[model samples]
Target: MAQRLVFPDAYAAADLITFAGRAARAGDGAVHLRASGGTLVTAAAPLLRQGLLDSTPTIIGMRLLPVDPELDCDLVVEAALLQIAHDDAEAVELPETAVPPPLWSAAEVPRSGWSHAGTLDLAVLAERAQWGMSAVAHALPIDPGDLIVQAVRGKIWSAPDEDLGGLPRGVAFVARTLGFIGEDAEDVGVRTCGRWTRLTLRRGHVLLRGPAHLGMTEVRETGHVAALVD
Candidate 1:
């Protein structure tokens, strides 16, 4: 993996920074960057399981941006570090050192063969996300332990959205939190390939692999999640 990635312009770099920043705030602070040809794919997990028995489905928010095609790289690094690198006005390339990839990144995701399943109403997604945020907030105690908080979140976010063809509510949460759904945003597109279901919007995509591919053991799970990219 290359240590540096150069965007075509400052505007392009800023776009990635915005995504990384939002992702950092929404989930764990790490972001995965993979380069292929002239495009850079950036992905972040907004909801993930933390243990072997945890039921949370892996939810990834991803976006693409143009980058210099001279180098190809795939790595995970802290979002804050990327922002700090971008802070330097004279730096054209973002410099990063790899961090341990998150477990969700190991899951296998389909690259092609997506068939349009349906469209998700942006208004419905927004409302569901808002309700989820409030539910999580009101459910946690003042000094709730990490496990308890994670459990509560996992349950709420993983609840299937019956109105939206049984897609997990966490998908909506990821889309709204990552700024994928906006006031003027049209209905988000939905597609499926194998066990993977993807919610596509103009800004980016949110992907969810069905529970069957989640893997029963931690090691197996992480390996599968990280296989999202070639």
Candidate 2:
């Protein structure tokens, strides 16, 4: 098996992302070296684990490629939303770029590997992440926005017309979304958990409640959480 390239925690990983973005902004050798300090090394390790970039600043003879400004901005935004504190060293408020065409792609910078500490926190993070993910998607030339909607449909529809037999709408919705239910499942109300949230269906309604951590999904069934690309 290969090494994990893990972070002390997701929040720590986020701070490193901000630092790398700023360092990528630096060009001159003096400035670049100045920005590439202990923090930069600490941050790059997790990214290295994900195969996003090489571990060393200079792979062999040549220097590592600099991070794009727009990519940097988006990363800052992403980490900002997930991080616990606002005192990140590279807390520069870059403007949101409009019009399409982001300089980077998902291959160079992955969009996954976020481990949460709490259930409500993960739900809240997912809500915030939707907008960030949208920004990045809008910048993509392929324009996959339509595909995103086709994929997700797990919300409570209090006025639903179909016969769900008093199955808690939210719990069933999540169960279906997670691929735990097929179109023809019966009398089954689902119960599941995530990093910090517990979701259960009882009497046609879903209850979402949890404190945090414990890899909550271990308590639920998911066909697959991630898809293979390429």
Candidate 3:
């Protein structure tokens, strides 16, 4: 089961508001913005007019069903604030009202394993590298491949083409973007939590190791590899 997130006051206002706007435009229903007393004074009016704010500002004894229940409420709130900052409301607030327990439980809660943590895909990473390299290519003489390797963290693992999703027990690439020791013209060492199995790759191969296994295609689309057992 995924864990439940109790939104803080900061999230309640800013993030919720932003999400409200996007959802409203998409016809996904309004995001409920609840508050008490004077907190909603300036905040509630504009949001209400935009139809982003729920007409009712009191969830005192009500329950909520988050579509992405496992999503970090804070992140959603942050996204919302980023979206609505240009609007009339400069700040968001949470009233002193009480919130009710969840009326309906989510089908599944987000898990707390390395496999469930955030990761990036090669393509997105490549795009980021392209953007960064474009910006500093003149000042810094570097290779795109080097930049991509530098961007990735932890360990990299590879598998036999047939056993891609099978159990992993092999040496993998270990690159460090943070706390980089020095700059040199040498391939970084590969590390792994398990033993190595004989596997063949084409000419060049990058080893990835985590409690997950993500393919190039999946990464390009979803931004990360598939999570596997640790």
Candidate 4:
């Protein structure tokens, strides 16, 4: 069975990218990252270590996707052996198999202008809004009762002061500005959008200096783990 592992938020996706990429480097398996077609990252290997993706991990960002209660998982290795071996029967030999790499892809933005991880990735959202605020604004609802605003405030204040330092700058900035509602609701909404840029320093969400593939060297140097397998 092809398993559908959904990352509830952008931070969650970044976490898997770091962990799986590191796992491959440490002889856990192979990992690849592709920026094309949704910034895909995949790790194809049996996790030598156990309990890596367990429990509801603390997410610092709003989740674009639905949450899964039973986060406990043991991605079985041997169960996939036969299918992997069968790949050899094809005319072209099966190059890689059996090892199921932990995978992550940037989920598309939802109807509510919500995102799984990259949803609020500030640059893209802001640029789009700048290009045509009217179009983007139609999709995102900004009111005191909005879910995004509440989620952002809840995540930031709930965490300890020391832990808050590690959050993405954009997110932290938004959290800091909380309760300072602007005279206009639209202005307040824009403020929330401004603070939601991608945070790549501690995690694997990095801005590429040059081409996406070449940029991965920076990620590798940072000891950030991630991969994209075609």
Q: Model 4: how far is 212 from its true place, Å?
A: 27
Off by over 4 Å in 3: 1-12, 30-105, 114-213, 216-230
Error of 4 at 140 (Å): 48
Name the runs in model 2 displaced over 4 angstroms.
Answer: 1-162, 165-168, 183-230
In candidate 3, position 64 carries an lDDT of: 26
Query: Which lDDT tens digits does candidate 2 get at residues 1-230?
Result: 21111233555444444443432332110111111212221111110111233111110000122222223221212222222234432332232322222221122322233332222222332333344345444555555463342222112222121232232223333332222233332332222234212222211112223222242222333232222110
lDDT, candidate 3, 1-230, per-residue tens: 22222333445445445434443342112223322322221111111111232221110001122222233331112112223232234333333232232221111222222222122322332333244334434444455563343222111212222122332212111111111112322222211233221111111112332333333222112222222112
On residues 52-164, what C-alpha lDDT tens digit does candidate 1 reach at each position? 87877679998888888875888888886775244554223454467898887676667767665666677888889899889999999999998888888998898887655
TM, every model: 0.84, 0.17, 0.21, 0.21
Local distance difference test, candidate 1? 0.74
Each prediction's Cα lDDT score?
Answer: 0.74, 0.26, 0.25, 0.27
Superposed by TM-score, candidate 1 places the C-alpha of residue 73 at a distance from the truth, in angstroms, of 0.7
- Per-residue error for 188 in candidate 4, Å, reads 23
In Å, residue 220's CA in model 4 sits off its true spot by 24
Which candidate comes out best when scored by TM-score? Answer: 1
**What TM value does model 3 have?**
0.21
